[model samples]
Target: MEIIGFIAATLTTAAFLPQVYKTWKTKDVSALSLPMLLMFFVGVFIWLIYGYYKNSPSMIVANAITLCSAFLLIYFKIKYAKTP
Candidate 1:
């Protein structure tokens, strides 16, 4: 079960890397939604807390990495916002 958890964690966490890299390289956040990102960040934070309480290493690691990615997306969205 723990191995399954770790595998799932690795796959899900890996999924976010491409987006982060793309955003970093292109600096194009026009397609990104701030509300969605904020919601995801909050949800991931909650999951992180839950994982901590449950002592699930997989959850903790995955959520921590995902939270960071979400945060970076949010930051990029704000930083790259076009001023009217």
Candidate 2:
């Protein structure tokens, strides 16, 4: 069951990477909503805390990686907005 959780977490969390890569490669954020990104970052951070409380390795790992991507998106949004 825990293996299943880990697998599911890996798949779902990894799914965000392509978008991160695309954004990194192209640096285009005109289509991304800042509000959505902020919400996602906050939500994943909360999930990280929840995972710690519950002692869930899957949740922690997934949220940790996802948070990285989320932060990247936010960083790009801010950093790229200045480019003309």
Candidate 3:
């Protein structure tokens, strides 16, 4: 079951990478909401902490990756807002 959980986490976590890299490179954040990004980042952070406290590797990996991906989205939102 750990393998299945890892695969699921890996796929979902990886699924966001290409989009994040593309958006970061293009600096097109016009469609993103800062509040939404902030909320997600905070939520993911809490989940990461909870995962750590619970000693669940699956939760830890998934939440950590998600936090980073979400951070990228938030970063793009701020960094791209000034772009014309």
- The CA-based lDDT of model 1 is what? 0.95
lDDT for 72 in candidate 2 is: 97
Candidate 2: residue 33 lDDT (0-100): 83
Model 1, which residues run further than 4 Å from truth? none
User: Of 1 and 2, which scores higher on lDDT?
Assistant: 1
RMSD of each: 0.9, 1.6, 1.8
Instruction: Write out the backbone clash pairs for model 1.
Output: none
TM-score of 1: 0.94
Least accurate 10 contiguous residues by lDDT in model 1:
75-84
lDDT of 1 by residue, 7-53 (tens): 99999999999999999999989989999999999999999999999
The deviation in Å at residue 51 for candidate 1 is: 1.1
lDDT of each: 0.95, 0.92, 0.86
**TM-score for each predicted model, relative to the true structure:** 0.94, 0.92, 0.85
Clashing pairs in 3: none
- What is the TM-score ranking, best to worst? 1, 2, 3
lDDT accuracy of residue 65 in candidate 2: 94
Tell me how far the alpha carbon of residue 17 in candidate 3 is from the true structure, in angstroms, after superposition. 0.7
